[model samples]
Target: MSASRTERLLNLLIALLNTKYGLRRSELRQKVYHDTTSSEVAFGRMFERDKGELRAYGFDVETVTDKGWGSDDPATTRYRIGKESNRLPDVSLTPAECTVLILAAQLWEQAALGSAARNAVRKLQAAGGLVDPELPPGVQPRIRPAGQAFEDLVDAIHSQHPVTFSYLAGSTGQEEERTVEPWGLGSRFGQWYLVGHDRARSDKRFFRLSRFTSAVVVLEHQTFAPPSSFNVREQLAALPELPVRYAVVDVAAGALLGLRKHARAGGDADDTGAATPVPDCVDRLRVPYRDAETLAEELASYGPKAVVVAPPALHAAVRRRLAAAAAFAAAPFPPIDFPRSGPAKRTRKRTSEDQLKRMLQLVPFLVHNQGLHISEVAQRFGITRKELEDDLRILICSGLPEGYPDDLLDIRWDDDHVYIIQDLDLNRPVRFTVDEACALLTGLEALNGLPGLAEGGALESVTLKLMAAAGEEGLKAAAVAGPDVAPEDSAVLETAREAIRGGAQLRLSYLAPQRDAVSDRDVDPHRLYSLDSTWYLEAYCHSAQGLRNFRLDRIQSLQPNGRPVSSAVDPAGGFPVKLFTPNDDDAVVVLELTRQGAGLADDYYAERTAALPGGNHLAEVRFGSADWLPMFVAQHGGSVRILQPANLADATREWLDAALARYEDSTARQLD
Candidate 1:
């Protein structure tokens, strides 16, 4: 019987680790390969692949060859992993430091780094270097890497692979293909950017993730060495801010108050002379803008309520977006293949590589937690009891080349409790992977911006200790990306936390964008949590008689009433995983999403989704209020289209058509 790949790799790792003088290729093949049917050439190929895999897993497989006779001959080379080089050194951290580290590691909410951070923290816990501590109330901070492109770029940067993507150039307003040797990725000015060597231009450049028009494709077969001192944060910081420009617009009275607040009356002869005629209730104003595309998106969202009069470029951009939205709204819905069994539950496939990584960490964890229940061990590793048992069976059969009873890993279970009698020098945790280090370090830095999370310089002390443990490579990888939270929001965040801690209700003057008004409301403080860079307060609203989420930035004023909370509702367990809390009264709307906008389904927490042709999706989403449905459709340009609910589809089409019609006369004049 042929041995499974997991068993083969385990045997190979054991053989290599136990060797003192390093074993020759022929000897390693003879010792590790249980299947005798394979040819010598095939065994050689498999051995080479296994060696590379081990190296990738952070093992330093050293090659040793005799100098006297065939020093340069591949046949004479022997391989072994140095124990001192491969093992993680002891890390001693204080309880306070452990608390801060745990928060830092959990900062990546749903990004690729989130899992990496969890694994890193688990390893630290296994090594007895981390003590689980209670988190601060009403102070949860999270950073989300934009999308799949952000994740793909991170992987490319780690592997030093070049990537190709279509990017819309903000400067030229053109879409172009770019092949870049990804150096680092970081968030700056509330946007994620990739700093890399552009192969076409043969110069370093920064590309914004939001500007990417296509999926990132990594050229794994090709790789390059980035400069050792390359830092993502520094490169992003050096980027010059875009020169701000102004747009003249006519906004209807009592409409788009958010826009009017940042705008001033436009009366200059040059600006007003070029302005198109507006109704008596409309006010002409000049609004400062940095990026025309970004401003255009915002203006398009207002539908016919706001019109860009001057800055022909901005006006034209807005008109184009509105026209596209209107065209999509009026178009026929695509055929959708709904699943009869309902939406498929998300499942993660456990590959051999995943299992091997888990086993490596599992050994050290079991060493620290002796006689733990088998079910508990399986739960900790996010696997089933049967899976854990299978792993244990495989481990017991793996050992040194001699395969003696004592030489193998001794795993015993009694009364549903599991214990590792011998770990074969794997009791110590392995060093952090690059992604794990980056996730943790970036998260810690983000927490630095939040007020009063850690005190007595514990945060800084922990950061320094982690840097030392991460080594040079880990530091370089971590430097590629970071998260930034606006420090200005700290005051409001502190106030909300205070209210929650004091068990007092808060009287808040909050801006309701949908209603275009600022209203005062009293609410019992629940919790303060942040998703990405935005902080939200989940509270029980007295006005609405239910739970509501208020943006900290939009909170005009907050004063704690000093009265004890009256609500009987407990805010402990119902913390939302998504920004929107679906209510029974929420309108169930169906929509179609283009390939570019398919991520919106996940963002909005769609109730059901069906696959359509051309990379589009049919989603059934719940809207708290459908008042903003038109804006949502227009804001996404033509990427989103309202499908079902005949009234909504017609309303969105009419809204977009009216917005586009406002530019008709100006467009005609230009053509003449």
Candidate 2:
């Protein structure tokens, strides 16, 4: 049965138990499936199935048959799951089994595992086992799943129903409609995939959840019986493996640390397994990859730091993307338009899964750490105090069904500390699920590849222990494919990290690309963050006498400044300075835009658009520097015109003339 239907059944059971007499079929249907009322025969069948499932799951559903019991009715049947049969007896789980349950719950932190993990946790809790859902600090792994489609598909799978949706196949990059009977779902390499018998294709196929482009609608009255011999893992293993080829690449020193695990395995190795270290700041390494295009994209992102030395296809793919990028820079582009006609939609609230996770973690936390400051708990859970309070309010009424005052969770707070009156016996930390363990192992491997962590470091040891726990199947389930940090860049990152950690300053030889120069500066390193595969350091520059953001790649050298950060400069006081912001040095220019160019109003000047006659628009555009204004206007290809600041317009015209002359001259040269 579907999880929703099972939930309804449980609610019906509770309602039946709450009454002195069993509820008739009509009463049960009205009370339980109120929103989904159906035909009499359909309701009877569903109710009967629900009762049978309850019995199968160890609940005794009692049926009272009445033969005109002092009334004018011919016959009547009423049903109830008695409390003695419905309520779970004492659950005595071993510590190891409890740990497994905890680990299973913790698996939900990853997006792909979240919904199923949450359902599992709730079921366990409902079964009267209070589970501690929190894992040890520093064990979190970043994992993103297939979002809403995953949850919907999980429901379809559980109900043995067919689901219809549009799926975008990666191989073709085209969306096609499909109806499938979902047999199972699995995660591999941090990606969720659904396996099912495709109705259109008449064959079982695997679909990546990420490819789902439309809502998964479960067929109302259609269901299928899964084969008794069906094995999800077996099917996944039987899926065809793509052809793999080895590529020999020249890697820069200290870069490609993540690939060192495959070190000396295939290349530059003698009879002994020791790797031959090629010198001259470049190492010849053999790397195996299945997808050439993917590998090319990854290698190209590294730019000059790494080069593909052999296998012409891989190199060509990288060069192709680079050439396309160059062509785009010299080409005129279409204006981007965003739809803005509809009324603003309400922001979605956190999912019930998120609420359940927080509650599961929050309860045990409060139970173990009684009298903890409410503010501290909120901070610990990475939620606002108001959100924390809202969760508490929700929990106040949550407990066993037919919720009596004694059955509900007892929560008490005195504006400062929070206390839980009842102990749920869920105070142990969650262990790691196989997939989660694999994900964390992958992260730890990347960390261990770094020089700072390679030499018997804590992270390295953790990696070893986790590998031991993961066993063979877990190791094969996921992989870590992170960017290769050049040794120099890694060292710079480490230095900045230490400065941030120790509250010290850093002396950096930084390259300013826009200024076409390199300069020395002392900066109080604040934090390090990665975006678009590039690491940046946010710091207070002593030379600039202001906060500045420095790309780690642009830092030629970095060293400690031998002084602690000043107390006056709070490391966390300021917000991130945007790359483009209104400043005293910037110019506010008015632009007259055609319909095509005006479409960009929301993007460029959402708050400064004014409609003009003849379907034109006037936008107030701010420029940090007018150096690129001419090129930017040229890129718009006459869709825009400068309306104010005559000097700026005249300068832009001259720049355009110069650019035209250069292009004309280049064309003439080519012709000659």
Candidate 2, residue 78: Cα displacement in angstroms equals 18
lDDT of 1 by residue, 202-242 (tens): 99988988777777899999999998788787788798888
RMSD in angstroms between candidate 1 and the native structure over all alpha carbons: 3.5
Provide the clashing-pair count of each candidate structure: 0, 1
Q: Model 2 over residues 1-672: C-alpha lDDT tens digits?
A: 443553465455446555556777766666566746577778767777877755654456777767646332313777765555532233444433454344333323433444334443433344445445333211212223334566566567655789989886656655799999887765533345688889898998888664565567789599997665454556666666668777666666756554443443335542234444443777777778776655765555444445554455665554544443333233432333323442121112465445544565577567767888999888766567888888787666544444467755688887678988853232322333333443344334333243333443544444454445445424443321222222335667777777877878788987764353679998887766442224677777788676677888788789987998863553443222233444577787767665444544433433355556665666667776676565456544445666557687776666555444433432353345
lDDT score, candidate 2, position 18: 53
lDDT of 1 at 422: 84
User: What is the Cα-based TM-score of model 2?
Assistant: 0.45
Best by lDDT: 1
RMSD of each: 3.5, 12.8
> Which window of ten consecutive residues has the lowest lDDT sum in model 1?
341-350
